[model samples]
Every structure is written in C-alpha cells, then in structure tokens.
Target: MMCETSDGDPGTDGGAAEAGADTGGDDVDEAGLAQFSALLEDSTEDLYDNAPCGYLSTLMDGRIAKVNSTLLDWLGYTGTQLVGRKRFSDLLTVGGKLYHETHFAPLLAMQGQVSGIALELKCADGSRLPVLVTSVVKTGSDGQPLLVRTTLFEAGDRRAYESELLRARKEAERARADAEAARKTAETERARLHQVVVILQKSLLPPELPQVPGLQAAAYYHPASTDQLGGDFYDLFALGDGSWSFFLGDVCGKGPEAASVTSLIRYTLRAACLHADGPAEALDMLNTALYARYTGNDPRYCTVVAGTLTPRDGTFDITVASGGHPPALLLRADGTTDFVRTPGGMLVGITSRPDFITSTTTLAPGDTLLLYTDGLTEARTTAGPRYSEEALHAFAHSLAPAGARQTVTALTGLLEGFGNGLDDDTALLALGVPAADGVGVT
Candidate 1:
C-alpha cells in the first residue's frame, strides 16, 4: 500500500533534510563564535583587576581617574573611595609626596616617562609599603598630556638587605678605630719602659774616668741590649800615697739582680783598696765578701781583674790581680804585645776560698796596658768563630805605638763593627805612660 506523504515526495524530502542539516551547522558555528567572544571579554577584565602588580591612572591635574582592583586591595581601599576622590600623591607617605612633587613630577614632565623610582605608599591601617614605581604620560591626539599611567612593585626585601649592609659597614669601621687606639697605647707604654731602662743602665756605669798625671787614661762600656742593665763595671780612683787603684769586672747574668751584684762588687773593691795593701789583697777581700753574700740555692759568681799603679822615676809601676779573668794585654814601647799571665785563679763568689793571682809590670815611656772583659774576645765573627785572645794579640801588635785615647778609639771602632756578633757587655780600660818628649800621648 503506497502512502502519500503530507507535503513532498521521497526525493524532495531527502533534499529538504540535507538543507536543514546545513542550516543547523551554520547556527552552531555562530553560537560558538559568540560564546568565545564573550569569554575573551570576561578574561581581559578579570586579568586587569587581579594583575600581579598594582596600576593607577591620574588626570593631568593629578586627580585619580582610574585604579585597578589589585592596587585598591593592596592599599586596603575600595575603588570608589580612590577614583575621582583622591590624587595619586595623596596615597603616598609625606616624604614620598614631597619627592613626587619636587623630583618625580618634574622628571616625568620633562622626559614624558620615568621608570624604577623608589617610593613609599601609605595604607589605610597607617603602615607603609616600600615600592618601585614606573609611569608614562598618555598624550591626546593633539600631542597634549592627558593622563599618567603608573605601575608599582613591592621593594620590602631589597630595602631590608641595604639596611643590613649599612649596619655591617659601620660595625667594621668601629672595630678598626678601636684596634688603632689599642696599638697606640701599647707603643706609648713601650717608650716609657725604654726611658726607664736607659736611666737605670746609665746609673750602673762610671760617670767619668779619673785623670792621672803624666799618664793618659780612657775607658768604654757597651751593653748588649738597651732593655736591660748589663753586669760589667769599672772604676779608677786614687788610694793613697800617690798610688791609684782601678778594677774591671763582669758579674754573672743581667738585669736588676746582676746590677745589684755589680754595685756591691764596685763598692766592696773600692772599700777594700782603702784598707788592703796590694792588688791581690783587694781581690781576696772582694772574693770573701761575695762568697759570703751569695750562696745556697741561688749561687752568683763573677770574673774580675783589679790593679794598683804608682809613679816611679820617669815610669809607672803597676800590679794586676785576677780572679778567673782573662789576662791583660800590654803594648810595649817596642811595638810588641803580650798577655800578662795569671794562672790557677778561681772565680769569685763561688767558694769560701778562691785562689787569686797577681802580676806586676812596669809601664815605661810609650807603653800602654789594656784591661777588658770577655765580651770582646768571645764576640763571634761572620764565620761563627770567636774573636779569640790570639786575634786580639795580633791586633794590638799591629797598632803603631799609641796612647790610651787612640787605642780606645781603635778598639771602640772594632766593637762597633762587630754589630750583632757582640752579644755580651764589654768594659775597656786603657792606661798609658807618656813618652819622654810627649810625642804620642794625647
């Protein structure tokens, strides 16, 4: 049974169905495009409101024309409260406001744009926020400035870092100043101690050598270090009956204790010379005194050479005594040198009975006798060998017949040349008899 369709034949209905499908596809495309457009518009407005950085726009008169939701949220103010009701500078701190008027505004006017300006913004809660700002002036079609668009970023962390750096710098400067002051104080104290040492050492030495008639006398003393007193001592003084007494000695060790022993020895020798008959007797007395005073756990000792001189017919008779001391060097009128031997003598202040030895020599015209401590002979050379008595003998033998002053000067130069090699105190005493014509005695 063939049923007739209400409107069209089979072929016509097929064609209509195809047309309806095409129209439906067009409508779907249109609807999709409209929805996409609405979505794009919504996204643009949301992005502007919730941007990561704050944004604001101000009119040419500085009145706020527009502000993003992000900026309003950061400042704890609603958009309605800021736009058209306040200016951009009104939302800044007092100092920031002044800076905006004086520097930021003028620079923007001149340059039409300013970037990376540091400023502080005031919040509704009265707190401040450090921020870096950038702004550009938007011009109208006529090239006239209409509005200013600005962007801001928080600078709290950067500000904190700079403040810490400043604090560290100030602390370092204070430390350096304190260290310098301490160093200066130490130097001042050292200077004061040096002065005291100098005065003390000078007191331990003879002020001047005694003058002898018809004879020339000279002496020199050198200390190894200036910080402490040396133990070497010497003195020349008249005894009685035209006889003069002299002595050179070196006490053990150095500093205040050794200085005390030196003082005692000097006074004892001088006192002994007053009552003793000869050089040997004077030394014996000194040995007895020193041994009695220094004994027990802390034992002290010294080496000494004592002498007495008397003027004879056109010559001088001298007697020298030794207590464990080096032999005296005698420079003869014939330009020869010899050590006056004193054997088997013992050190003073070591035992109750120390053997002292005596030797006698006659100082004739152009004859000089030199007495010294071990500091000279024991001085080390560059080769690490000592300037022994043998070398000294050779030195004295080479000198042309000279008197006390000239001999002392030559020896002083020698000592100075020794430099750091001379590590001990040296005491020198030279006595010479004048020639008949007084040729070389000065």
Candidate 2:
C-alpha cells in the first residue's frame, strides 16, 4: 500500500484495497495538501522581501515597478517612493548615470541579460554606494517584453581598499622624490666647500705679478688637484729704481700651514730687500726669520731662488741667490742654451745658519731666462723613466732664443705630453727682453 504526501507524489499508497483499508483515506490526504500549499505561499512572499541581495523590476516604459526591502533600505526609500516614482537611473551616481545611458542600457537591451557589473548608486543622503548589479529582461508568454529585473550586491569594501592602495603608492613616490632632492642638495654643499678652499688658497698668492719694465715676464702654477691647496708660488714685483725682484719657491707640504709659510716667505723677502741690495742679504734675512719662527718639532723648510734684475749700461744685470733650488737656464739669441749653476746653497729653515750662494749674469737684448720647481723635471715617462735635469736642459737648448711666453707655453705642452704621469704641481717663471725697438729677429 502506497500513501500520498502533500505535493501529490505517492509516498505510501492511500487506498489499501488489497488489505481492505480504503475508508476515510481520500478526505485526509486532501486536507493535508491544502495546508502545505498555504505554507509554500507564505515562504515565497518572505523570500521576495528579505533576499540576501537587492532586487528591482522596471516596466516596459523603464519606470520602477517593484523593489525589495534590502535595496530600498540601501537607497533610503519606501515601496511607494520607488514604485512608479523613480527609474533605476535615478538611483545612479553621476558617473554611473553616464555609463548607464552610453553603455549599460544599450548592452542590456541587446544581450537581454547583463550580469555582475560594477556601479555606484546614489543614496537619499547624497552619498555614493558601490555595488555590483546584474539585470535581465522579463517577457510575457506572448513573447512581449514586460519588465527588467536586476540584482545588486554591495561593493563598498573593495572600492575602499583599492582607493587606499592608490593613496599609499602616491605617498611613497613623493618620499622618494624628496630623498633624491636632498642628495643633490648635499652634493651642492660639498661643491661650495671646495670653492671656499680654492679661494683661500688664491689669497696666499699674488693676484698678478707686476709688469717689470723692459722685461717679458710670464709664470704658471699647476695645482696638484682642484680640491687640495699646494705650496708652490712665484712672483715678480718692482724693487724701486729700474730693478725687479722675483722668486720661485715650494714649501715643505700642501695645505693651510704650507700656504702660511708661502705668504711669510713672500712678505719677508720684500721687507728684507727694503734694507739690502745683494741677493745674499735678502735670503739671509728670510732664513733667519723662518728658523726663528718654526720650532724643530714639526719643522718647516722651503727651497727658494731669489733674484734681482736692473737695467744697466746697454745690458741688463742679473743676480741670483739660491737655497737648495735648481739652477737657472739661459737661452742666448743665437739658439744656444746653458745652465747657470749655483749648487752650494743649503736648504733654508733647516739650521740657524745654513749656507747660501749667489751668482751674477748679464743679459743682452735677445736672451731669455727660465726658472722652475722640481715638479716639472721629476715626472715619470712612459717607460718609467724619470726626466733628468740634463734632459730638461737639452730640451730648453733645442728651443733657445724663446721669450717668457713661448718658453712657459712650450713647457706646459711638454708636461701635458707626459699624459697621466704628471703627478705633481709645477711652477714656472721666465723672463726675456722683447724685440728691441722693432728690430725683428724674424
């Protein structure tokens, strides 16, 4: 025997004729089915009002016909406010309204079903709510379009997360830019410090050597590095009444202390010559001052050559006082060169009474004299060869009869020719008579 359940599929047979049990079975089954149908109707109405997502329906004219409680609550509206009063586009944000008009409505009409698209809805409080919507066309049995149904899901959390990430990335980029700007500012400060040091170094030397009458004079000072101050200097200044005083010297080391010593030597030489005529007397005064001022603990010394020139009776008279410096070069008008040696002088500031030497020469109209520090002649060559003094003398001999400008220019070119081997600061001073009274040698 089979009896029927409420939905009309037989569970157990109601009629038990085989066992003689057919009485009162039909009436009981009918009553139970009526109760089941009423329960199903109530559940359907509850599902329509309190669905997990939102629901909406529009008439054929695109007017709102129905909306669920969930959607109405999000929009801050009642059933009367939505139905027949507002369309789906009225709930969109400005951007959402543009998208609905240009793309969403056309796409829904063509495809008949559009699913799971992002949008923003305008709430009654004038705030925007992010959502995902799916819409489909509804049709009657006669194949006539009657309404459109749409589902909505809240997407506020996802939109907020994406916005926060963009803000963080923008902040990180600004921090990186600020760091780069600070690095460049630090570099700029370093350059300014270096420039200050360079200016201080220049103050230790003469701005320009005075122009000695009837003499072609030129000089050069090559710094070991732009960042470091060296102690090499030379100057040519007038010593009253037709004679000029000049010097070339290098102090013991580089930096501020050496620059101090350099300035001391220059001023001391000038002051000493105010009371003397001979080269030996001037250098003697410099040596005594240096030895007295510098203690032996961190002793300071310098190699120097002090010379004077005076125009006398058809030729120029020249005198030199040497203190452990190289000999001078004389280039004659007839292309001959020789070293005027003064080799017996002791290094200045070494002892209280170190020996000094003096030499004398006469320069005719077309002669040149060259003086230099040790940096030029001591550089290494390509084959690891030190440029000997003999080689330099020979090089000058080959370019004899050249005046001050030409001589220093040629030497600068030679130093450059050594390429990477010029490892020290070079100082040069040269003097010669220009072509006398337009008597051209060429």
Model 1 lDDT tens row, 1-442: 0111133332344454464475674565665645544544444445656778888888988999878778888899998899999999999999999999999999999999999999999998999988899999988899999889888887888889878888988898898999899999988887887788778767877789878887889999888887778899888999878989998989999989999898899889889988998988888899889888888988888999999999998789999999998999998888889898899888988888778889999999899999999999999888889999999899888874778888888999999989999999999999998777664566
Candidate-wise lDDT, in order: 0.85, 0.80
Worst 10 residues of 2 by lDDT: 1-10
For model 2, the local distance difference test gives 0.80
Off by over 4 Å in 2: 1-202, 378-395, 412-424, 435-442
Error of 1 at 244 (Å): 1.0
Residue-level error in angstroms, candidate 1, position 116: 7.2
User: Against the correct fold, how does model 1 do in TM-score?
Assistant: 0.72
The true-structure Cα RMSD of candidate 2 reads 10.5
Colliding residue pairs in candidate 2:
1-13, 2-12, 2-13, 2-14, 3-12, 3-13
